[model samples]
Target chain A: MSTTVTQDMSFLYLISSASVLVQLVMLILVLISFFSWWFIFRKLFVIRNEKRKTDDFEDIFWRGVDLNALHQRITSARYDSGSLERIFAAGFGEFNKHPAGSDLDAVMESTRRAMRATYQREMDYLESHLSFLATVGSVSPYIGLLGTVWGIMNSFRSLSSVTQATIAHVAPGIAEALIATAMGLFAAIPAVVAYNRYASSTDQLATRFESFMEELSNVLQRRAAG
Target chain B: MSVSALRNSSYSEPRILLAGALAVLVHLVFIAVLIFGLNWKDQQPEGMMVEIWTELPTPIQESVKTQSPPKQIKPAPEPVKPKPEPERPKPEPVKPEPAKPAPQQAAVTPPVKKPDITIQQKPDPIKEIKPDLERQKKQEQERLKELEKQKELEKKKELEKQKELEKQKELARQKELEKQKELQKQKELAAQQQREQAAKAQREAEAQRAAQQAAARNQITNEISKYKALIQAKIRSRIVMPPDLPGNPIAEFSITLLPGGDILEVRLSRSSGHAVFDNAVERAIHLSKPLPLPPDPALFNEFRNLNITVHYRE
Candidate 1:
């Protein structure tokens, strides 16, 4: 009977046996995953509300209500106005600032400038922390890979101390190292998928906002000529 | 930038942290379920074993004249599995052994008697031919004398010839008795030698058998300890010790094992006094089911009921 004194190796054992560098890598990956998931869920609500707000504001905008009356009503409930409604407000507000019988081209240009500014600000808000999701999606896998490589390296380094090496000697090391990669992918995959979905939906909203800006600019231009 | 940062609703730390805690809770629950589920599967005991018994030793003599010696030590094929019964009548090798001496007495007797018959026949042909020649000569002489002399002379000669014939019969009887005595001595010598050889062979066979029995016993102990160590190794790996226990607590168990290494029962013969500590050790053994066992059924008797003491600290 060979007296091979094997210590109990479980998931806990794997973590306990990990080298310092690899352990740090695992800790970092865990935090990254945790934070990424937080942003992912938070962004889910933000994007959904943006879409609903855009849709609701567009329905009223297309009802052909008087511009002055629509602007006044929305200005009173300005906090509730979506990107589309805000854009409309900015354009009409700038148009009212122009004196009656002013140069029509200059008036339309001023209105266009105000509408463009609101569109940029709204797009910035829509796109904020989206980069954070993208960063998490693309970087977490690499962080996990870094942990795996370090763990395996430490595992190999342990082999140098072992005079007689068997698979059991290094199996725990490799398994522990691979867990880092698994966690990384767990954090990255959903982030990547959500980022793709949200980015596309935001682009759809952006396209609609741009088209509304053009339509509103054309209406104001005609009103100026009349 | 500070005023704007305060203005950004999306970057609120409290809201993000609450979201993170919820997300982490979901993921942690999912992982815990998977890991614990996998653990239950691993804990199942599916180990297997088959008992083996080597051939009993042969003392190196075959009594049967026709068969070769190769078959002498071939082990008997294993009988049906005697399941459920934990005990069997042990076939202790020390019992009465079938005699194994080859019969040499029948081959030795004939040559001892043949010489006596050959010696008696050598003088018989010569004695018969000489008498016949002598009688022919005497008969010719008597014929001539009968013409020349009276009948009384011939009668006297006849009595003398009869007496000489009686003497010759007495001599042959004495010779036959001598030859019989010589054959008897030779038979006795052959029998004595046969007895000596048989005694020597018996002594050798007995010595060889004693040596074989000793060897078999040694092999059995070595095998038992080897398996004991193997089982301990497997069980030790499965053990999950309770943390922060005081002293080096030791627990002892009396385990009943089947021939195939399946643990029939494990009784806590002595507890470590710490219930959780004792429980962990028991669970370890349960997980290490179908413990490693000796392959020989003969050896299984040693392990059939065994006492194992597992030390918690060590």
Candidate 2:
């Protein structure tokens, strides 16, 4: 029992002896897991920053800070603005472009257009590569299954020439096959969990940006009317 | 300008490269942990584990010997002492030598003769008791002589009985010897008879075996001929002998057969001078289809090719 179990159950041993196709599958799974982790971390930081900056912008905006002063301060700073800040910046920047005597409807129309464009662009940045995470989570196991199927097929293919087969004869191949699946799950579980978590956070941030846009347009309309 | 910068920062190639490099570092750490941190040796339970399980200390088994009942010890016999103490008075007899020394003074020391007289009186009593002792000793001697004579007579009678018992044993021994000699003669005769019977049985068995072998050989030869005739008969039955074509014709065809007896080829080794007779023989062999073969597969090789001479007249 011990001899058969330890035949190729070692991590390095399994990796080294795995068939080419299963090895490739394992490589792909590891790459997916790693690359997805990268996105997960990057999005984690980006979405957190957006949420923080949006909250900060909302607090100051409600504190009755002068709009022109606020806009100037954000534009002067070299840092990239959050989704909400960028939408506000775009509207304020577009509003400042019009002359004092310009048609109010025409001025508000162009400002809304700028904010809308920035909103979409900012949300696009937040949601970028999220589909890759979803794909990794949803499809990685099947890809791993393909590797397992191929490995088992190879083991059985080698077995056809043999007159008798024991567990020791087939264990290594099966173990290597299961390694693919284990790696796939390792890649997929975090990806799925992160995707669910980050997708929800991004959606929440998008909702906040949309609400801020509506409030900003209303305030700008009052300013233009006066 | 700030908004444009912000939009470009989100999809920056440098950020992706940095993230990918960091991910590579993470994967390396994971691989290292899997390689170095995993204790591979402890995972397997080896043959040594079974040996360790039986390593408990063994208890020594002491053999208990059954004790024998102690013998009743007796006092040992006392050693005998030599009895020569009565000769101690011989030294006192030396006083008579000192009496001889006083011979010159014998007449003058006549008053000292009283001690000599007492000493002389001491031997008188010893002399007087000696007669009684001698008589008692003579009587004891006679009694010993009588007991010795009786023991001698009993010993003579025992010797006579022993002689008689020896004579009877000698007679029985001779009778046993004769009985053994008779039994041995009978055994020898029985062994002789058995030897003769064994020789006769061996000879009969040899003859029967030889006859059986010859019969089996003849049966095999007869069976072979019967089949050969059968094959020849089948082909002959199919033959339309060319009637009245010429002198009595004969055709010999060497036919090749498969294991299933399918005729492979029929070559005329010794063709009849008449072409019609030879053609008729060839046609008959073809019509026979699969020729009859012996049931024995061993005979198949013999039928691989067979030469059968057909007498057209017959």
Candidate 3:
């Protein structure tokens, strides 16, 4: 029994002994899982970085740093600046483009538009591959199920030639087939958890960006009115 | 946003490479853990006792011993053997043949009487010894009579012994004949029983084979019907029926399908009498490319050439 388990139930044996179509399905699922994880890790880094930068910028802005000096410092290091910083710069730059003598309402409107566009772009970046993660999370299990069903069907079909089938005859095929579902769940669970986490965090970041936009627009509004 | 911040929004190539490398490393670690972790633990096996046999057990020995009734029948025939005892008297006539030699003994006795007469004539010459000779002749006659009587008694005893021996021989011959008949009857009975058993087994085998064939045929038909329903459903779903004044017209098609369930040839074997409906059915049959089939390849032969009749109602 020990020998049988070692020989037949090995991971490489199960994957290699699978039918060609089932092997293809497993390969596709593995590649999908790999890419999803890659995206997951990438999103993890990007979102964490964005959140840290947002925290830093919020601290500086609320500390009442001189708006012009902050803007100049951000423009100088624009290449390394975060998403919230970019939104702030866009708003500040647009505010500066219109003279203080211009109609206050028009200047405020243009600044808000500029900030909103920049905020949208940053949100787009944050939310880029969450959909891919979602697609992988939802569809990979079905893909695994497809492989399983096909594998079981093939196994049973082969049994047509056999007059008397025992459990030993069919067990290996089923075990190999079930490996696909196991892999599917393996791939899907992490993707789903990561997707949920990243999606909500991205939503929170968007909310923060929106609130910052609103808050910055009001500050600009007060200055323009004065 | 400024273009430089847009550039920051995009991931650098180095970061993508690092993420990809990390993903590969993580997956490798995960697979390695799966392989090694499962193998590290040893499972305890349940104990089971097994008996090993060098040869198959033969339960037939007792049955074989029981089937042979001839041993018991041998004892039964022993009592019947005594019934042939009345035939024991048949050897009694042979006892008289040994007494035919008594006539030759009588001829020899007449010659002894002539010698006795000569001895009497010589007795007159010797008057002094006449009385003694007469006494001696009388004693000799008596002794001869006793010897003759003893010979007759011995001959009778010998004839009785020969008769008894022949009677026993006759009984043994009768017993032997009866035993031969019994043995032949036993052989015939065993042959008949063996023939009966063989015929019965053959009949049973034929019945079982017929039943299995019937069951296999039923299963095949069931599978074929199931696949037929599937193909019909596919075609029905694909049918873009031409609207007209037709009631429920049935169209029959003789379809030839490849092993993979792809349509090879679709000929309208029996038209619905409406060319439009027939054409529509044919078009639907073709439209449903590679129709659903049973996964079993052995059942595909039954589905290779199908004559399906479609009613244009539902």
Candidate 4:
């Protein structure tokens, strides 16, 4: 049969009005998605550089180079952006501030405080803007469902005017409404993936910072006692 | 004490005593000022009465006292003078009468004339007579002026009464005109309501006729469906079954029929699964052209566009 399909614009109007909240939520999701990608890429670059610098510094430090000479090289170059390098510099600077043969306990206390402060600063920077990604991952599906509910309500309301209902009468409206749900999933999947990945990377970096602090503290303690 | 001990001892005791005494003196002064000031403030009047007392001068106070005492003494002196004036007049009149009786009595009354001279020196009787006569003439003039004012007021009241009567007549005329306008407005409103009633009745009759037409149209639709079913069955028999049908395929096809029962459009809602079998169903619909027509024009119009579902494959 030649199926006569008619759409009431009033249905669209109802759907659009109900979808305002969904649209607002989707807008926020999209913004969060964009910012998450941005942070992921930026942190990827920063962490990669930090890893390289840390590896180089560890190599140089264990090679029996004089620490004062290494300090001069680090000061002049200023190229190292690693957390370990900053921790090392803070601890050593505090160690050099005291007179020679001062109390070993006092020297170690100052160096530990300096390294803890630097570690806190680096962790804060790495963890910034991560919460928004988490919120997007958790809430996006519900936001998309809100849009789908609004669209289905409009479809059912228009069915009242129809004398004999058929698939042709309902399909297009349902299809258009489902697009929002699909978009929500689209925005949410990447956010969730990025959050899990970045969180693990940040945890690894934090563990490294803590272990480095302990090792550097032991080194400064020995230097003070000697 | 040694020299250092002597110096320290000399400085310390006097300094401590002087500081202690100064502190005590300061506390005593503070306590005295607080107690006495509070007592004096409580004795003072509610607001500032000092302003009112400062406004009066000594000369005004003195004038009030002097004026009150003089007024009290002047009334007493005037009564004494009246007594002397009456004695003097009695002696003068009594001398004439006694000359006929006793000349010696008339000579004794001459001493009463000296008393009259004492009264005249006081000048109180002459001042009292002048004031009394002046007061009586002033009261008579005041009474005459009051009578003239009463006559003028009566004339003004007559003019006011005439104006009030004119205003009352004008107000009555205005009230008559307002009543006439209100009556006219009521008449117009009643006419408008009658016109509206007539129009509303006409609209009701028109709507009833349209509803009757719609009912007739529905009856015609029922009759056309009855006849179209017979024609559809007749056309179904002429359709040949295709031999290459797949495995007992069963489906239905619907077609829109025109006014003369000619198939307009055809589609299969349920597919027979075999492409050749489905194509045969479509060709059958095309081959059966203008199979039958309805007898009545209204019934024919009702079947102008029709939907039919046909079951294929037995």
Candidate 5:
């Protein structure tokens, strides 16, 4: 009998045999964990791609590539271009829309505005679904805890129906309940770690974009002044 | 609106699908690995948490074992010597009797006393012959000759009697010596048989005692395990382990028990470092009063002080 009980203590058995509420809670945690991981991976790809694109654009731009040629190349491949390139194209297009003798400060301001708007959209694209990761990181543990508490309560309540209460009587219930907490920890740890890593990387990319925009604005203002 | 349009165009649907597929694959792999790992773990042999005291160091057992050999050797020659000693005294009396009888015969027959007896006989014959002096003188000569002849015959008869007595005594001495020799041989054989019998009896008794001791030790060990299991099971049942105890921490306790199975003392020899677990174990030990002890009083020593470990899992 004990052998059977010990054998049935596997995670699959425990999860499968859990009470309805606990099962529901575990389901919620699993869904949260799955989606959180999905977002984590997607964000990982997005941030890495964005960082590489920014590095490419910065290298080419700094090596004194002709603004017109660079702008033309970026605009031709607009759909395939990175966020930094789009921001540069937006700023350069806004600069060329003014006459050669236009007010330098007004042209520079409008150029900065276009770059800022594009920068905002690119940052939004990079950080999408990150809130879901943050929510999973913060909330899944509590949901798992709730499942555990409900499981323990159910087990103890069932104890009232029995005359003798051995650890055997209550141990399986408690063991099954503990799996919820374990699942919560399992889901929360990775989500929290991924969220932190992706958030910092996105922030780094935003800084790079802002610096590039500032440098471009200065260069365009100098050309207008010249 | 333009920024939203541009962001929508920048998004690649294939990449999202790829990431999602990878995520599902990763989760499925994790579940499969978990299932496989747990199944593998199920095959693992559970560790033994309870250690029972089967062999006790007993000085008396060693003494009993060492004392059997000398006892077998000591009595072999002891009874043989005393029995032969009493028999030797019996032969000594028989030897002295033959020697004493020869000296008594020599002292009884005196040659001076024999001369007096001859003088008396001569006087008696002279009184009767007073009237006939001449005839008496001839008769006296004849009587003297007869007396001399009778004395010589009597001396010869006494010598023959002495020779016969000496021969009889020598024969008796020879017979007695032979009897004593036969008796001694019989006694020596009896002693040897007795010694062999005694040795066999001693060996059997020693073997029986050894067998009994071994049986007793086995019984003690069996009873110890029986009661140890009982006490541990009872305590384990009574234990209300604190939830969330990390790992399988073992709490060791040395329990002192009375003869009647009542707990005298319980000291935590090794703490599991979880106070709640330690306290729960301690409480359980206290709650399980009057543990099941072996009925035999001799086996009580084995159950007197027990060292028990309560593993968190077990």
Candidate 6:
């Protein structure tokens, strides 16, 4: 059994050594394909939950609820992935830290800083693995093309010894080469589509966070001044 | 915290990790299978066979006849001696009748008498005569030495003949070498002459090209000077100063005119601090219509869309 395993491994090693560039390209494609599927599934769930939480948070926020009560509710839950909730938490925490009747400028500056920090964290979460998705989308096709070029080179090398080259002789190699390309597209197309969709959603959420921070800061400023 | 909520959060990380690991494993297995298939398909024999011989044992390989007893065949016959003279004389009277049959009978008779007598005698004294046979062999050796001396002389003659053939080949080779050298010298001389001729031709061509370029440049310069004068004259005649213009301006004003001698646009390329003076110069250019055209077409081509620089002085 061990010898057979070793034999199989050495056989693979021979193929890899015969065309290292193709093997490397295929390896990279496989890795990208794996990671792409992982991210696609993971992000699908994450982004869906984020959308739901954000919508629920927004609804509650606009329903004439007391700001302090909303802060308590968000703090108690603790795992809120919503962008608006984080922004609100950051601003409210800073607001509570300062003494009552502090100057409006000092209060607003502290709130803005907190909100900015939280905004960065939210954006980081939203953009996680997005760059990997982007890399996969852009590089997979070229990687697949590299495999195709190497396979064609092998085919031509075979032709030097063969008197007659028919479709049967060439087709399997071409088919295997094209499998890499098909897998690459399979990995890339969804990644690209998902990236675009997620990026837009992230941007919209970011805008919402910014606007909420602005409104919250104004409200705090007015309270301090009054 | 709710049990359902806590369970969901806890399970998410493991679920994601498991899914990621499974995906990676699947892809790795797929790649491994692909590579294995490719290798199995492409495998080819690489080594060649070499033959080697082994010797059999010497004793066993020897002929079996060498170990067996010797066997003998019957002795060969000897030649018949001529009959004695007495017998020949007696047979002469009967010979005519027998002579015709004698030749035919001689043809049929086998000469086996010598070996027959040796086989019959078996003499011990004749066995002792073998010692004399050795002495007779020494005498034969002397005869062979004389023959060898004659053969040596013949070999010397043959060596001379080989030497003559070698000398002829050497002479032919020398002639061939001389012929090749002569041909090479002729080729070199012809090549040298051709190179000198080509150089001379190239020098003449270069000189002709330089002379043509000089003439062309001179013609162009003369044409440019004529056109410059013609353009200056046309401009001086056509340009008109406005009555309201200042006597002195700080800077020179350059105005561009279009084809047909109409002012298409004007700009203060150099701005005068006095805006009114600059404006007046611009107005003067606009008022000047259909400036005088150069009579020569070559001059006109140069002066078309002319840029005029006017300096105002107090």
Candidate 5: the clashing residue pairs are none
Return the DockQ of model 4.
Answer: 0.02
List, for all models, the DockQ compared with the true complex: 0.12, 0.24, 0.16, 0.02, 0.21, 0.10
Off by over 4 Å in 3: A1-7, B1-14, B37-314
Ranking by lDDT: 5, 3, 2, 1, 6, 4
Worst 10 residues of 6 chain B by lDDT: B71-80
lDDT of 3 by residue, B1-314 (tens): 46445546444422666778888887898788766653443221111111112112223433443454454455445544443343333333333443444444554654575467547644643553465676665565565567556656655665566567656765765675567557655755665566557655765676678679989899889988888899999999888888873688999999999999899999989989988888888999999979888888998888889898988886
Itemize residue pairs with steric clashes in candidate 1.
B52-B295
Q: Which is better, 2 or 5, measured by DockQ?
A: 2
Show where candidate 2 strays beyond 4 Å. A1-8, B9-42, B45-314
Cα lDDT tens digits for candidate 1, A48-70: 77788788878877888888898
Candidate order by TM-score, decreasing, is 5, 2, 3, 1, 6, 4
lDDT of 3 by residue, A49-91 (tens): 8889899999999999999999999888855688889899989
DockQ of 6: 0.10
Model 3: colliding residue pairs? none
Q: How big is the positional error of residue B94 in model 3, measured in Å on the Cα after superposition?
A: 79
Clashing pairs in 4: none
Q: Where in model 1 is the C-alpha error above 4 Å? A: A1-7, B1-18, B37-314
Candidate lDDT scores, in order, read 0.69, 0.73, 0.76, 0.60, 0.80, 0.61
On the 0 to 100 scale, the lDDT of residue A163 in model 1 is 67
What TM-score fits each model? 0.48, 0.50, 0.49, 0.40, 0.50, 0.41
Model 1 chain B: lowest-lDDT 10 consecutive positions? B94-103
Per-candidate RMSD, Å: 24.3, 24.9, 19.6, 37.0, 19.2, 32.4
iRMS for model 4? 38.4
Index of the highest-DockQ prediction: 2
The residue ranges of model 6 lying beyond 4 angstroms of the native Cα positions read A1-21, B1-314
C-alpha DockQ for predicted model 1: 0.12
Residue-wise C-alpha lDDT for candidate 2, range B1-314, written one tens digit per residue: 76687566545422556666776787788777666643354255343344445542111101111111111011111110111222223333543454444443443444354457446644654664576576655564555466446545654565565556555655665565567556555655565556556655765686678679989888777777887899999999998877787776788999999988799998999988999889998999999978888788886777788999998776
